[model samples]
Each structure stands twice: as structure tokens, then as C-alpha cells.
Target chain A: MSLELIRDILVATVPLLLIFPTLFAFTTWLERKALARIQNRIGPNKVGVPLTRYGGRFSLFGLGQPMADGIKMLFKENIVPRDADRLFHLLAPILALIPAMLVLCFLPIDFPWINNIQDSVKAFMLDGAVIFFFAITGLNTLAVFMAGWASRNKYSLLGGMRAIAQMVSYEIPLVLSAVIVVMMVGSLNAAEIANAQAGWNWFIFTPWGLAAFIIFFIAALAETNRSPFDLPEAESEIIAGYFTEYSGFKFALFFLGEYIAMFAISGLAVTLFLGGGAGPGVAALPWLSVIWFLVKIFALIAVMIWLRGTLPRLRVDQLMGFAWKFLLPLSILNIFIAGSALHLLAGGRLAGLDEKQPILRQLMEGANPLVVAGLWIGALLILYVAANGLNQLSRAKVRPREYKYAE
Target chain B: MSEQIAFWILSAIAVLGALVAVRKRNLIHGVFALMIFFAALSGLFLLLLAEFIAAVQILVYIGAVGILLLFAIMLTERVAGDDGRRMTSRGWFWGLVVAAAVFVVLLLPAIQQWPTPEVTQAPDPSVEELGHKLMNPYVMTLEVLALLLTAALIGAVTAAQGMRKPKEEGSPE
Candidate 1:
């Protein structure tokens, strides 16, 4: 409502608006490249103009492919199916795209861009960013459903249903993991969480913090409909899924929304787990902090790309089972761990006795570095074994039987 | 002025969307209109300084409920068209009567509670305060909501499983 607040909103939004398009563009290129690598072939080698003057290619490894794709989608004919609900069909993509775009408002790209006018003038500040982020991302499910339903295609409807189930299931774990972060930092503001993890004692370093990070990462994958959780658009099974009936720029908008959502989740992961824009003693050079933040985000995005390349799509039942049986329980446990840890860190009393008293303090002291590291390694090893066991079980379960249903 | 303008715009959209949601013949259009209604409600919540609530409304209603409704409509073959099959006998007369009664009832409240020119400042609900209230004061309620969500999950899976079985067995072709 105030001028400073308005300025803060503008300042926070501009970089996101600028960066998102580029991220979306690059992520598309990244996905193509990764998928191509998986298939052992070159991808998008001839999209951009060649720079003859410097004897170098003008493009940065098919960087301009997104632009080319966008242009092509724009020029292509927009078709409305005869059986489709005209009003709903036309409105669906816009609805989906707008909500996806609106999520950036609550995400803090970095610390408040403070400027000194009369000692202190906070340039960009947001409260309750975590809630805002989740809330906006949640709207994505609606847009997806609308697209599917409005299309009047059975495949689209099925895709939409799958998406809704996936999104709803993942959202719980996502919120629960965020609750853990909120417990650790004692704040919901994205910037505040980053500030809390200013030094090497990042949340991702702690036991509960690590749990929250993994839970959040998996939930994010499901939320974004990326592989191995991309059941919504399983091309072989669903035939482009929800977007099957869409074409041209309308289809482009849905694609853009997908990439933007991916960027948003990656940015959130960096902010929550990787200490955000915080770098080693980078407070002296504030600009470097932003660079560090971006690096972390891109790294997270690369992980998403790697996941797409390495993992197979999960079975629908398996995805749902994992969400309910594994993610939900783990996230709930993470929350309890985070809450107790924060309570100890805050030096709060255990029952009636003072937590700072000599005996109690010794008992409630911070986790030993070695113990923490050992516990982390142990947990990782257990997880690896469990994952491998599950993989083996699924393979055994799905193997073709000797008795076939042949005539 | 901006705030007032935003309020009016959102209010208008909300009213229009609600009307379309209820009156639209096509079920899909009705659902899409409901989405607009949810968006308008979220915007109004934002204008009222309940950003968290606004976000939740968008998340829960638009994201979850809207999708559920869409799926329900799409999956049911009976609700797919507007071939006069959806209209009940004497529907038009009842609809008009209901519409008139609702309009009168709504107008009566506005007429009885006429607006004053002077505006009173209300306490802004800060997110921090809300967070404390949620965890410290309403923790039990939060737990109950979590339980409710779990129940919903179980119910949905059971229902979907029931649906899946018949389809799988019946599809001999």
C-alpha cells in the first residue's frame, strides 16, 4: 500500500519477469538436449543464425531454438474442435497460463534490495512467501483440468484426471516439507528463510533439513509433472494427454506454463535448501550473492533435466502409492523433527525446566558435526537400498509369465 | 483509488462469473466460469489484505475443487451435452422464481444496510499473526484438517479403484 512497498513489489517482479522467459527458453533447450542425449543424437543444431564476422556460430548451442519454437507456434493455425465447448476451450489456456505466471509475485529472488534514503529504506519485502508460493502453484491444477475438460476429448479428460490426482497428492508433501522449513527458520518469508541459512549451517545440512529438501524435491517433480512422474502427458499412453486437442499459440501457452512452473519450483528449492543467494562471505559483494543464487537455481534445474533423462515414468498406481505411503509419512516425521530441533535451537524450556540450565543445555546441545554427517550418510545408504529393493520388486512383479493369453 | 478500482473490477468479475457458473447450459462452461469466480474471490481476498487466505482459496478451490468438478463432469457421459436432456420439467419457471427470490433477498440486505461515505480502518491480518494462530491456537483444527485430507485421499482411491475394476474386466475387445 505504501510507496516503498509498491517499489519493492516492482523491483522483486522485474528480475523474475526478465529471468523467467530466459529460463523457460533455456529449459526447453535443456530438455531437448537431454532427451536427445538419451537417444544418442544431436538436437536443435540448426535453429539460430551463424555469426560469420567472428567465425563463430551466433547461437549459443541452439539457444535460439525456443524463440524459433515460439515463432512457429504463433504462426501455426489455431484450431477449435467442433465438438469442444467453445467458450471453455478458449478460456482454458489463458486461465492456466495466468495462474502459472502469477506465482512469481510471492517468490523472493534475493534479499530485500534496500536503499538508504533516510538510514533505512527496504526496497523489496514480502511476508508469508511460502504460503503464497504454494497457493499460486496450486492454481496450476485448475488450469490443467480446464484444458483437459474443455477439449472434449476422452484422452484429454483422462490426462486431466491423472494430473489432478498427481497434483493433489504431491501438494500435501510439498506443503508439509515447507512446514518443516517454516519450523526451522521460524518464518514463512522466502527471504527470511534464506537469511536464516546465511552461513554454512544451511537447513539442508541438518537431519530434518535434509529430509525436507528431499521431500520438497520429489513433490516439486510431481507438481511440475516432470518424469518419472509425468503421467499427465505420457505420449505413448495418452497421446499428448491433456494438450492433445490444443494447437498453435494456445498449445504454446500450456508449454510455457509447464516450463515456468519448473523454473518457479527450482527457484523455490534453491531458496529453501541451497541457502538461496547466500555464498561464502559474499555479503561484502552483494551482487555476487545474486549470481550465486542463480547458479544454485540452474544447478537444481540441471538436476531436473538429469531426472528426466535417467528415470522412467512411474506407473499411475505406483506414483499415488509413493505419495501416500512414503512421502506423506516422511514429511510428517520431518515436520516433527524440525519443530523439536527449532525449539531446542531457540533455547525454549523442555517442560518446566529452563533449557539453558547446565545439565539440560548439555543434553540439548546442537548435534555433533560427526554424528550429523554419519547419520546423513546412513540415511542416504538406507534410502539407496530401499529404492533398489523397490525397483527389483517392481521388476519381478511385472515380468511376463510363461502362461500367455494367446489363442 | 487503485484499491477501490481493483475492488470494483474484481467484484464485477466475481458477480458475472457466479452468474455464468450457475446459468451456463454447458457443464464445462459452468466449470470454467467457476474458475473465474474463484479467481475473482482470490483477488477480493487479496484486496481485503488476506493474502494467505486468497492464496488458499485459489489453491484449494481453483486448483483442487475446480479440477475435481471438471473430471466429474467429463467422466459422466450423461452430462456431456445440452440436448435439453439436462433440463428438468418446469425448470424454466422454477429457475425464474428462484432467481427472483434470490435477487430480492440479496437486494434487501444491501437496501437495509445502506453504505456510509466514511470508511473505518480495519486491522490488517498479518501472515505472521496468522501463522501463530494456526500453530499455537488452532493446532487441533489443523490436525483435524490433515485427518480430513487423509480420509479424502482414502475415499478417492477406493472410488477410483472401484471404477477401474469394472472397466478392466468389461473391456474384452
Candidate 2:
């Protein structure tokens, strides 16, 4: 390849490779500190930057904790189970990481450095970029399964099974919810979707968009195996799930992969629902779009961390039921609602609205905004009732646990 | 030159993966190897500029089918297959002969240097174009395929549920 081509490829990818992993390191410290603060305790306060000869005195509130953890992991002994498939055990973490890193390219973060890059090298420039993102992220389940089964441990196997089932179940709602955006924009290209939502035209502001965003967020939380839906790696249940037998750098790799996947999915959510980098001052200062993008991502990540601190991990049955029964139907319905609303308001079908609203036609020639708004309200109500009914229908009627001898 | 290199590398990976999938004795390993083949084939599709098909290949074949195979293997008695007697069938000679015959048939056009159809113009590779084609001209075919898949899914679910009567519950205890 020519030097310019090589440079273009590097310009396209190098920032993502450097930025997200660094963010991953910092996010670990942030999660711990945040979770600790939630629990009324200080976390990682001792690992600060060293200034003096004796490991420095200014312990900057554990800012150096992730670096310290990295070093510790590097020096720690690599452990492998005797009966494990050593090849798969070695491959699993790498497999887990590759897809997570690959999907990062599909996020439309417009850095100034990448502004001059050729379209061929930019992953999100593709017409089916969103679908490609889902396809790549789907491989993460196989890696988790590989780690679980390769470990040759029952708990690991259980964790793998749970991860696969949960991921496969949640992916439907996740993709379905995202389809609303693609439907709205009439393109699957991330850049196009983001551009369609320019100047506060974020899909999240619309009723169907809001519902789709909510479903997408909930499904994303499950997709990343985040808290309230972390049945796959529930420590209390399966002892860290798929990576139960992984140690040291391998374990750290899994951790890094998980955090990156969280960032990637959050990036996609921001891209699909939050108008991507379409914040103010972006036209004058193009680079500000990167800040807006990261800000949106971190905002989503903060909510994830907050939920982690608040909601307990879901039970397996509850997790499956929530996806298949609740989120799936709602997302499917949201697509139809969004589609019909689009056809009514913006699209040129002009199908049945005029005949139904003859009185409104008397007020003005084409004043159908109230009619459209009313239709949206009615649609949202149906969605609300449907959601509640599905919730009621899918709920398992198990009696509360009885404590007779406790305390 | 870059495309050639990518094509060669991806084709190599696809071939090796398929070979390993067919040859491996361990069921799980075989399934994973098949997934590798699917993934590599998707890469080849991407190389061919068929990004939609590439994504769908990974989505349907690797993400769905590979996972299904893994689940099926997990459900079996001896998933590891460590106690395997023989993987190859006793009719290996016939199998090879039939395989060779099929391969020869498939290669006939290329081997004879048959004249390929000339393109009036290069078709747009954009997924939007594909979507228009599918929804406009091929909508019936697409809908039929969707219905067929849905039927298969429902049939599988029904078979899994089986024809058993519901249990008579007397008490919550």
C-alpha cells in the first residue's frame, strides 16, 4: 500500500485503539470509586502518582489504581486448569477481545485527526454499518462460551450457558430497537443516522423514539452483561461465570473486553438515539463533536454504573422473560408505531388521516399536527397498556421466601 | 494488490477452518471450527464487496447456527467425544468418489474456459440498492423466505414442547 493509504488507515483506527482502552483503565477506577461511594466507603485511595523517592506522598485519590492493577496483573502467575483445553483457554480471551475492539470502529466519533481519512478505511461509512456492528458484537458470546467450556469447570460451563442464552435473548430486542432509527433515517450508516438527528432532533425526544431508546438501553445493559441483567457472571451464583478459571492477564483481558463492550454498546446507543455528536458549537468547532460523542457515551456509562450500584442482578428466568416477553414485543410494536407515525406526519402516503379528520380539515387546509400528536398519544397509551399486560402475563407467581429460623 | 492479499488470506483461513471442522473428533471443537469457517467466509464476502451478505453470513451462520450447534452438542451425551471409535464412515471410498464428481461438475465451466456473461453496467454495491431490489422486485421471494423460516421456528418450538398433556395441579405446595 501507498504511504498515504497506510496513514489513512492509521488515522481512522489508531485513535479508537488508543482512546477506548485508556478509557477502560480509567473506567475500572471510576466504577470501583463510584460503587464504593454508593456503599459509603472510600475505594482505591492509596494508589496515587508517586513523586518522591519512597513511592511519592501525594496519593491522588487512587488515580493510579488501574495502572497499579495492570502491573499487578502482569506480574501475577498465569494459572491453567490441568484438564482444560489449553488451546481454547489461551484463545478465548483473545477471541473475546477481538470483536469488542472491532465493533468500536462502527461508532461515528468524528475526531479532527480522522477528518481527512478516506471513506474506504472508515468502518461506519458502510451502508450496513449498524447491522455490521451487531454481527461483530454477536461473536462475543462464542468467546464467553469458549472460556466457559475450555475451563472444564461446572460453574464456568453454567456461566457460559447463561451468558449465551441471555445474550442471544437480549440481542433481538437490542437490534429491533435499533431498527427504529434505521427506519426513521432510511439508512443503516451510523453517520447518516446521526446526521438525520441534527440540531436537537434526537430520536429520544419523540415518543416512539423514547420507548425504543428505553428498550434499547435496557437490552444494551443486558447485552453488555451489565448490572440488573448480569446473570451470566453473577458472582454470588456462578463465581464470576465464564472467566471463573481465568487468571492474571487473561482475567484482566476479560475485564478489559467487558468494559470495552460496555463502551461500544453505549456508543451505539448514543449514535442511534442520542443524536451522536450533534451538540451545539459543532459547526464552528468541528472537533467539539468528539467531545459531545464521548460525553454522551460517558453519560450512558454513568447510568450503567448507577444501575450497577442500585439494581440487583436478574435471575435467569426473569432475564429471559424480560427480553422475550417484555422488550421484544414492545420493540416490535415501537417499530410499527414509529413507521405509521412517519407515514402519517412526514411521508406522502396521506392515507386515512384526511378522511378521519374532516373537522380539522375545516379549521385549515392541512393543519394535521394535532391529529398527528393525538395519534402518537393514542399509540403510546396502547404501548403502555401492552407493556403492563405483558409484564403481568409473563410474571411467575412464586411465593415470597419464608424466614422461620433466621435472626 | 491489497485485495488479492486479503482474498488469499481469507480463503486460506476458510479452507483450513472447513478442513478442521470436518476432521476434528471433538464435537465442540468441530462446531467452533465450523464457526471459524463461517467467519472466514464472511470475511471473503466482505472482500467481494458484498457487505450485506457478509454481515448476514456472520449473523445467521456464525451467530445463530454456530450457537445452535454448540447448544445441540452440549445437550448430547458425550459432548467431548473423547471416547470416539471412528469419525469417518466405512463408505469413505464412495464418499470421496461422489465428492470428486461434484467438485468436477462445479469446476466444469472454469476448466473449459466458458465465456461468462458480459455486464452492461456494474450494479451498485450499496445496501440501499440491495434493499430496493429485494423490496421492489423480490418482495414476494423475501416474504416467502421469511414465512418459511418463521414456520420452521414455530415447528421446532412445537416439537420441543411435544404432545404431552398439561399436568393437573392440586395444591401450590
Candidate 3:
């Protein structure tokens, strides 16, 4: 490749490589502090610079903890069992790290922050970026299995198996929800998807979009092995699961990979439904777009942290059932609802609002809110009926418990 | 020149990876090799400017299919070790002969000294056009495929569940 092309690639990639890891470290600290506060304790208070000079006794709130942890982890002993498969044991973490980094390559961070630059400030613009993101991110399951198998430990194997099952199950709903957005926007390009929701026209305001977003977020939680669905590495059950035999830097690699993947997917969710980088003053000052993107991502991450603090871990069977019986069917039906809604609102000849406005703008403006509301209500009715029917079906299969008084 | 070089390298990798995937004795190693094959194939698709197909190729085949293969391998047999038993029966020679025949048939077009067609640059179809095509003329085919997949899923679930004896009768005891 030419030097110019190489430079362009570097300019695009360097920020992502640096920023995401830093964001991840910051998130780790944030989650600890937030979760700690929720549980009525001071978290990570002594790790950073003390703010004794500011009259109060506020420290940096353990902001430096991730950095310290990183250094300590690097120095810690790297351990591998004698009977473990040496090559795959080493290869697994590297494999896990690959897809995590790759998914970030397709995400559009801002809407042209640089002067004399193009419309969008994406790292790379691939027409099929959405699918590409999903494809690469899904490869983590293979890495998990590899790590589990290579460890030659039963806990690791169990962890790996659980990871594969959970990831594969959740991926269907994740993709299905994304497909709904694709249906609405009628493009797979991340930039195009983001741009479609420019201004205050974010998808989350609508009913189907809201449902799809909820499904997407829940599926993302499971896919990333976050709390409530983190059965793969559940501490109490399988003793750290797939990475049970990993130590020091290798374990850190897995941790880094998971957090990065979390950020990357949440970034995608923002781009799709949250009007990525679409905020006040962004239209006039485009550089503010990056800040908007960061704000959205961190907000999503904080919610995930909040979820981690609030919810108990789900049972394994319940987790799988939730993905298949609930999410899969809900997501599939949601695609139809989204399609019908789009057709009525945007595709019809009568949908145009004004003669001068663009078709999309016309559709957004001219579409009857009352009719749209009715469509969503009908969708909600169908969903409620479906859920109720499924619940009754499940209930019929169960025998009621009979209680006897002590004799 | 660079594009040609990339195409050649990717095709070579694809072929070699395919060979290794089939020839490997250990199932997990074979699966990993298959992943390489798929990756190379996707790279080839990307080279052809069929980026959507390339993404789908990687997503479905390498991601989903690889996991499915692993699950099947673990479910049916041990994760490590091989008995070195041939997967096929005594008809291996015929299978090879059939494969060679098929390969020859497939290679016949490439083997001929065909005239180079006048190169015409066509703007690559956007994903919108592709989606329109799928939902329009190909909608029937898409519906059929969906039905086929649903049927397959149901069949697999039933097979996994197996033919259990009536629980009602057993519960009476």
C-alpha cells in the first residue's frame, strides 16, 4: 500500500486503539465505585491523588486503580497447568482479543468532527459494517471454548461450554433486533444508520424501536457475559469459569477483551437507536459529536453496572429459555411490526408531508402520530397475547405443589 | 497489481486451508482449519467487492457454523484425541474418484483459453438494492429458506428430545 493510505489507516485506527482501552479502564473504576456506593461502602478511595488541598477530603476516587491493577497483573506470575494444551492455552486469549478489537473498526464515532473532512468521522466505512461487526464479535465464543478446552480443567471446560451456549443463544436476538433497525433505515451501513437518526429523530422514541432496543440491550448483556447472564465466569459456581486456569496477564487479556466488547456493542446500540453523536450544538460544532458519542456509551455502561449491582444471576436453564422462548420470538415478531410501521409511515404515497421537504423528512414530519400510536398499540397487544399464551403453555406442563401440615 | 497479489494469496490460503480442514485427524484441529478456510473465502469475497456477502460468509459460516461444529464434536465424541479411524467406509476410493471427476468438471471452464471479455466498470449495487431484490423477486425463495430453517430447527429439537415413553403411565406408579 502507499504511504498516504497507510497514514490514513493509522490516523483512523490509533484513536480507537488508545481511546477504547482507556475507556475500559475508566469503566472498570466506575463500575467498582458505583457498585460500592450502591452497597453502602466507599469504593477505591485511596488509589489516586488526594484532594486534601480542596478543603474537603476527596481523593481521585480510585481513578488510578485500573492502571495500578494493570501494572500488578503484568508482574504477577503467568501460570499454566502442566497437562494443558500449550499452544491453544496461549492462543485463546489472543483469539479472544482479536474480534474485540476488530468490531471497533466499523463503528462511526462522530459526524465529521475534522475540518475539510467528509460527512461522518468513522474509522472505516464498509457497506456491510453492521453484519461485519456481528460476525467478528461472535467469534469470541470460539475463543472461550478454546481457552476452556486448552486449560484441561473441568471448571474451565464448563465455563467455556456455558459461554458458547449463552453467546450463540443471545446472538440470534441481538442480530434480529439489529435487523429491525436495518429494516427501518433500509441500510446496513453504520454511518447511514446513524445519520438517519440525525437531529431529534432517534429511533428510541418509537414503540417498535424501544422494544428492539430493549431486546438488543438484554441480548448484549448476555453476549458480553455481564451480570445476570455471566454464567460462564460465575465465581461461586464454576470458580471463574473458562478462565479458571488463567493467571496474571492472560486473565487480564480476557478481562480487557470482555470490557472492550461491551463498549463496542454499546457503541453500536447508540449508533443504531440513540442518534449517535446527535446532540445540541453538534450540528454547528461537529467536534462535539465525539463527546456526545462518549456520553451515550458511558451512560449505557453505567446502566449495565447498575444492573450488575441490582440483579441476581439467572439460572442457566432460565438464561437459555429467556433467549430462545422469549427473546427470539419477540425479536422475530418485532421485525414484522417494524416493517409494517415503516411501510405505513414512510413507504406509502400519502406519507409525504410537504412538496419541498425530502422524502425521509416528509415521512418523519407528515406521518400521523395517532395512526403510528395505534400500530404500536396493536403490536403491543399481539406481544402481550403471545407472551400470555406462552406463559400458559409453560404453566400447563408443570404440576402444582401440594403442601401437607406437619402431623 | 496489489489487488491481483491479494487475490492470489487469499485463494491459495483458501485452498490450503480447505485441504488441511479435511485432512486433519483431530476434529478440533479440523474445525480450526475450517475457520481459516472460511476466513480466506471471505477475504476473497471482499476482494470481489462483495463486502456484504463477505460479512455474511464470516458471520454465518465461521461464527455460527464453527460453533455448531464444535458443539457436535463435543456432543458426539471426546474433545481431544483421535482413534485414527477413517470417517468414511471402504468406498474411499470411489469417493476420491467422484471428487476428482467433480473437480475436473468444475475446472473445465478455467482450463479453456477463453477470450478476455471487455472490462466494464459497474457501480457496485448498494445494500438497499440488494434488500429490494431479496424482498421482491426473491421473496418466495427467501420464504422457502426460512420455512426450511424453521423445519430443521424443529426437527433437531425433537430429535434431541428423543421419543420418550408416555410420562403419564409411568407417573401412576
Candidate 4:
């Protein structure tokens, strides 16, 4: 309602709106270049060639490829499959784009651009950002399923099913890893988490932090349906997968949504793990921290591209197995470890750790060490046994005779 | 005023979508409508100062649930049956009466006794505070949720395995 509060909301949201589209564009370019390099072929090298005395040069192997792709997609004919429910087919892409775009609202690119200027403005500001992030990110799965179903193709249907299964499976680990970070920092606001890691002792230094980082990275990969986990769009198996029937701008929306989602995930990971926008001893130049955050995000994105180039697509069963059998248990353990360590450190019971005045910390520390150790060991044993049991169960269920081809 | 206008438009779209979801014979339309409903709900959540919940609502319901429903519908049936007729039988009068009764029941309290706003508290329920609460006093709840999720995973895998096709005894004729 107040001018100052309105200014802050505008400032926070404006940059996000501008930055996300630009980032999405950059990701598309990066993916193409990376994929091309991996395939041992020249890619998109003919665009944006300036006519110089040197007879023009292909710039960055056509870094403007995304622009070209975008233009081409826009002009292409929008085809609705004859058998498709036309109304839903038309709606699905828009539905997908909206949720993907909404995620940016919760992301804290920098400190709240506006302090407490007006009470009304404060209401709009996202304080519990991590929860918002997870909630928004979870919506992408629904968008994907909608696309597949709207296509009315068997391949699309299968792709949708695979995507839903994979996403739901990985979401557990994704959330759990986030919980670990929350456990360590005691806050879910992305900006606050970054602030907490202001100094050298970023959460990444802790044992649980490392585990969380790995879990989050893997889950992000799976969540985005990038290669090694891209069964949803496995070209060889399911053709174009969910978006098989889409063409033109509708198809482009899906494509843009994917890149944007990837960027968002990378931003989230950087925020939670790599001290988002927080630089080393550069607190004076707060803007440089933003650069640091972007650099970290870029590095993460490059790693994802590398993953796409290197790893083969996972079989659906294997993907599910990895999520349920490995990542879930690991995430749970990581949370426990993080919680206990924080408790110990706060109480000063652990040597070289601080003794906090908090009674909760004291209680946790005062508890029997042997009991804690036993519980930890017991958890590990149970996980191991459960994993083995699951493997056995899956093997028994497969029953080799069932898969035999009946000619 | 503009924000309110946007909210009304989005809310209307969402309601329309939900209606279409239930009324349309085409399963795919229903899924799309559900997505619209989610998007609209998310918009509503945003209006309510529950941005986190809004985002999650869209992400999970629109992105995941809508997509899953779409897939299920597509896989189970062909598109030829996608008439604009109702998929389920309509009990219009009874349905309206029931819906109206529920709405009144929910709204009557607010209408009769307007609630007083509480004093603004310090250290507002920010994301950080939520995290601290979750890890500290509510640590046991977090642990329990984790356990519940693990059990669910085990159960899902077991059920999937159980539904696997029976082994073929010999080659088909």
C-alpha cells in the first residue's frame, strides 16, 4: 500500500522476471553447445556472423542458436493432433509455463530490496522461501503429465507416466536434502540461508552438508528429467515423449519451461549449498556476492550438461530403485546427522564447538551418547537390510518366465 | 484495484476449469481443467500472503498431479470417446443443495462473527523460523514424516511388483 513497500516488491520481482528469461535463454544455448561438443560435430555455427574484413566469423559457434530456435518455433504451424481433446491440448502448454514462471517469485536473488516500509507489502514478501521453492517446483511434474495426456499418443502417455513416477520418487530425496540444509541453518528463507553462510564456514563444510549437496544435485537432475534420468523423453524409446504431438509456439513453451526449471533448480542449489550470492571476504561489495552466486549456478549448469553428454539414460526400474533404495535412506540419515551435530555443537559437548545458551541444545547434548550411537547404528542396519530385502522382492516379482516373448 | 481484478479473473478461470474437469467427457480436458484449477488456487494463495503454499500448490497439483491424471486418462482410453458430455452422472439439484449447504456451513461463522486481527509478532514466521522450529522442537515430527515416507516407498514398490504380468508358459499360437 505504501510507496516504499511497493518499490521493494517491484525491485525484487523485476530483476527476477528479467533474469529468469535471460537465464533460460542462456541455458538453451549452453545445452546445444555442450550437446554438440559431446556428439563430435559442429553445431549452430552459421548464425550471427558479422561481415568483417576477415570474411565474417561464426561467433561462439553460434551462441545465438536459442534465438534462432525460438524464432523458428514461433513461426512454425501449431498442430493439434486430430484425435486430441483440442481444448485441453491448447491449455496444457500454458498451464506448464505458468507454474514454471511462478517459481521465480519465491527465489531471493538478493536481500529484500525493501525493508519494513508498509505492512501490506510485507504480506506479499516470501519469508518461508524454501517451502515455497519446493511447492512450486513440485508443480512441474503435473505440467509434464498434462502435456503427455493432451497429446493423446501412446508414447506421450507412457512418457507422462514415466515422468510422474520418476518425479514423485525423486521428490522425497529433494525435500529431505532441503530439510538437512534447513536443519543446519535453522531457516528456510533462501536469502537467510545465504546470509548464515556469509563467512567461510558455509554449510557445505559439514558432513551432512556434503551428503545433502549430493542428494540435492541428483534429485535436481531427476526432477528436471535431464539425461541419465531423462526416461520421460528418451528419444530412442519414446520418440519425443510427452511433447511428441506439440509443434510451434506451444512446443516452444514446453522447451522454455524446461530450461527455466533447470535454471531455477541450479539457483536453488547454489542458494542452499554454495552460499548463494555470498562471496569470500567480499561482504563490502555485496553485489559481487550475486556474481559469485551466478558463477556457482553456471558451474552447476555446466555439470548438468556434462552429465547429459556422459551418462546414458537410466532404465525406469533402475531410476526408481536409485531413488527409493539409495537416495531416500541417505537423505533421511543426512537429516538425522545434521540435526544431532547441530544439537551437539550448540551445546558445546563436542570439543571445539560452541556452547549455546539454548536449553534445547543442552538437552540434546545431555542425552546418553551410547543411546545416540546405538540409534545411528540401528538406523544404518535397518536401511541396509531394507535395501537388500527390496532387491530380493523385486527380483522375485520379475519372474523370468513372464518377460518371455510369446511369438 | 488492478490486483483485485486480476484475482477475480484468475479465480473465475480456475472455477471454470474445475467445472470443465468434472463435466467434460474427455479425460484429457479434465486434467487440463484440473491444472487451471491449481493455477487459480495458486493465484489465490498468492493473494492470501501464502506465496510458499501457492508455489507448492501449483508445482505439485498443476505440474505433477494434473500431468499424472492426464497420463492415466490417455493410457486407459482412446480419444474417440472425448465428447463434451458429462463423464459421470449429474445429480444437479441434490449436488447444488449439498454444495450450498457446505458453503453456508463454512461461511456462516465468518459472516456471523468477524474475527479480530492479532498483534504483529516479532521474528515473523519467516522461512528461517520455520526451519528452526522443524529441526528443534518439532524434530520428532520430521523424523516421523521421514519414516512414513520410507514406508510409503516400500509399499508402492511392493504393489507395483505385485501387479507385474504373469509369466507366459509357452510361445503363442
Best by DockQ: 2
Single out the weakest 10-residue window by summed lDDT for candidate 4 chain B. Answer: B118-127
lDDT of each: 0.75, 0.88, 0.84, 0.72
Q: Candidate 4: what is its chain A TM-score? A: 0.82
Question: Model 3, B94-138: lDDT tens per residue?
Answer: 999999999999999886887778466855746666777898899
lDDT by residue (B78-172, candidate 4, tens digit) is 64454555554578879889989999999988777577764445334344445557778999999999999899879977975677677788958
Which pairs in model 3 have colliding backbones? none
Q: How well does candidate 3 match the true structure in TM-score terms? A: 0.89
Query: Superposing every Cα of model 1 onto the true structure, what RMSD results?
Result: 5.4
Q: Report how far off residue A265 is in candidate 2 (Å).
A: 0.6
Poorest 10 consecutive residues of model 4 chain A by lDDT? A354-363
Q: Which of the two candidates, 2 or 3, achieves a greater DockQ against the reference?
A: 2
Q: Estimate the overall C-alpha local distance difference test score of candidate 3.
A: 0.84
lDDT of 3 by residue, A95-212 (tens): 9998999898777885342223432234346777898899999899999999998999999999999999999999999999998777666678887888888878888877778888
Cα TM-score per model: 0.82, 0.92, 0.89, 0.76
Off by over 4 Å in 3: A49-59, A111-124, A343-361, A372-407, B84-108, B114-125, B159-173
- How do all the candidates rank in terms of DockQ, highest first? 2, 3, 1, 4
User: In candidate 2, what are the lDDT values of residues A172-235, reduced to their tens digit?
Assistant: 9999999888866668899888887886878887788889999999999988999998888889
Candidate 2, residue A173: lDDT: 95
Worst-scoring 10-residue span by lDDT in model 2 chain A? A355-364
